[model samples]
Target: MASTPIIATLLKGMAMGAADVVPGVSGGTIAFITGIYERLLAALKSFTPAALLVLKREGWRPFWAYVDATFLCALFGGILLSIATLAHGIEFALAEYPLQVWGFFSGLILASTIYIGRQLHWRALVVLVAFCVGALAAIWLGSVKPVNIPINTLTIFAAGAIAICAMILPGISGSFLLLIMGVYPVIIAAVTEFNLKLLLTFMGGCVVGLLLFSHLLHWFLQRYRQPTLAFLCGVLAGSLSIVWPWKHAVVTVVDRHGETVPLVQRNLMPWDYESITGVSSAWPGVLTLFVVAVVMVFALEYGARRLQLKRAANAA
Candidate 1:
């Protein structure tokens, strides 16, 4: 057969790449969004001995024999291209118009949360406990600041590994992890400005993390599926903290030059632990956006299912 599947994989990867570029979203989520999550997972799991042998001996030429090489190439190609093409636009958009962007994303995630939450097979007691656990933990973690860990190769590698997991898992955003860690803006600016040294170091860390973590997750899925699903549901729940739409910020501190820096912002997400009282919830527009997001995801899933059935029918 012609490598049509390979070409299709690249297209899927491109969609994933766009997802990866955005904060509070993930390429893995995009994989799920685009109806190729299972294939992506299978491909991740396919580092077999024969594959290794081909990679070791015949190199890139023989990789196609072992896996849908076209797909892999296409997907990565799309991801890289997305990073290159979309990153700056996303950055500029967020800078120029933050509240509106955040509002839309918050809505997207809220609907996503509901969609994923309803899929859980938790019983009454389980649902109550899981929601409480998930919500409480999210509230708790939202208040925690990034402990200033020393920057080193090992730490970078570990950070990369851990960060990649968020990107892979639905509802968890790798960018959110980095933001919580106080590195999200730093790294994005680095990439945006094309700082070679910083970019390479970050990539080195991410690669090491991905290789080790993907296998660990695979093992977890195989052996502890129920608990894993529960935990993931919790994670999806917890992530809502990062995207809450509104909060109060004070105009207290001045810059070092005493130029009287006026207005600034702080978050209730962090300040709630300090006995600060503030109400933060989605408003009407945000809620509408959330509903739209749910509809979008459902529509995408429906389309994907129809395509899959058609393809299967043709094969038969």
Candidate 2:
């Protein structure tokens, strides 16, 4: 079977990693937009007990072939490398230019919502209901207050499982889910400090969650693509609240390092933010960035389509 170039897959994975680091933007959206979503899901779904049996019976080469190991390894290596290299830079940007960062992500997700919604041909009431439910659920989840939880092995494992599942779902972010669960800081600390034990535990949970959830999601997409897409669109719609550029932290807590962090925040209008914080609203800059993000998505889509057409012509 023809396969995507390793460099291309690695770049896609890096893009996904960059998205996954943000609160509102989803790696799944990047995977979808980059035309790797189905292929990634299919690769993940290849990991079954039966495949393990083949590993034992047919040896390493056949097992690797069955699992598409080369693609998975290249992609996942890129993801890990991205996280390791970009995490601190992303953290700095979010701290220094929160509004711009949020604006960019909001715009990206808005474009994704439109893109995904356009693919759905369903006009059924049930699909609409699913969309509404997904939106409402995300809105509520976004509003929930973060609770302080002890950083332990079991908690890390559980956080990994939940966060990983969200990470792969369109419009849901693993890092955001971690923030919601109160483990974001701990996980970030682990990554920055090179805490191997904690990292390994979290990764184990991620592997388990990714394998299981990918199968379920793959099946759903295959059987009910329209409704599934509608639901994802709704999720992206609802997540906008979480990424709103202007907000005031209503409740905050001092962390282990004595840095103040928001535990709960309330969305604010641009004018209201200026009124409360006595800072420039920078509305024009935000709007410009948002428009740029939207245009970037469309440009990426156009390029991907052209590439596909070129490939088809060559194959013919």
Candidate 3:
């Protein structure tokens, strides 16, 4: 409720916004590492029909209390601000330095897998199988080519629903989901161009999907922590296929903006990337950035742990 706490929440939301923009990274991962994941789920779960009834019966203040509106507003305000400000910068980086950008994301995800996997009370056989299944599904999904669908209200709405669901799930990237659905570019364009009508439609779908999926995920996590974590670890492991630094596009398509982009790509070694793309590959730079990403995740985890300890000590 204090300005200081609100500012901290806003910063966390900004971090989540930055992660969500990248293809292989999930905002949910940020939420987890920042120590807000469970609280966020609990807040989302508060948005029940009973809450709405309370809103009608007791007015704005009671409704806000029922839903933790202050926290949600601050968090989402930060997310939207980050997205609006960072969209072009992220897009430019991805275009101008694809290898480095992806390398960083790859490192972040790899670290995330380790971080989340550690939280599981591992049943060796079950965890392994869950990890494998998640990885295989992500790999298969990565290999699937994007389809060219006619952009209409319904299509945009559906894309938002699906993408938002993925976005909130740890190890699953919502932007990657959009890319797979062939709507990433459209959505990016909408954001950059300030296309309010298209943005609103997509947001409506996102709201619906997020509300429903958050509740389901909350239940799943509460009831099946180990299995859920295992599956998420697997998802992160499998998603590596999508963020490999060196890749050659196996299939390409022209988007609505008449720009050529990769539809399907085959992973390549650094030397092979140089040979194929005729670009310097810059292996040193890529590796350095990748390491930086990994270190950053660990630093975040350490900070969050310290904060938790401090809170506990103060309460005691």
Expressed as tens digits, the lDDT of each residue in 1-316 for candidate 2 is 3588999899988988888887777898888777788888889999999899999999999999898889999889888988888889898999898899899888988998888887876578878988998899889889888776888888899888888899888888899889877788788778888899999999999998999999999999999887888888899889999899999988898877788988889999999999998998788888999999899888988998999899999999
Candidate 2, backbone clash total = 0
Candidate 3 or 1, higher TM-score: 3
Query: How much lDDT does each candidate structure score?
Result: 0.64, 0.87, 0.86
Model 3 vs. true fold: TM: 0.95
**lDDT score of model 3?**
0.86
Residue-by-residue lDDT tens digits, candidate 3, 1-316: 2122889999999988988888778898888777788778878889998998998999999898778788888888888898899999999999899889988888888898899888876767777787788888888878877887789999999988898888888778899888877788888889999999999999999988989899999998899777777888888889888889999988888887888988778999999988988988889989999999999989999987887788779879
Cα-based lDDT at residue 267, candidate 2:
92
* lDDT per residue as tens, model 1, 107-217: 555655665666666775655565567567655655555443555556655666677777777667777567556566566777779977777777787766665666677
- How does model 1 score by TM-score? 0.76
Q: Output the number of the lDDT-best candidate.
A: 2
List RMSD in Å for every model shown: 5.4, 1.5, 1.9
Estimate the TM-score for candidate 2: 0.95
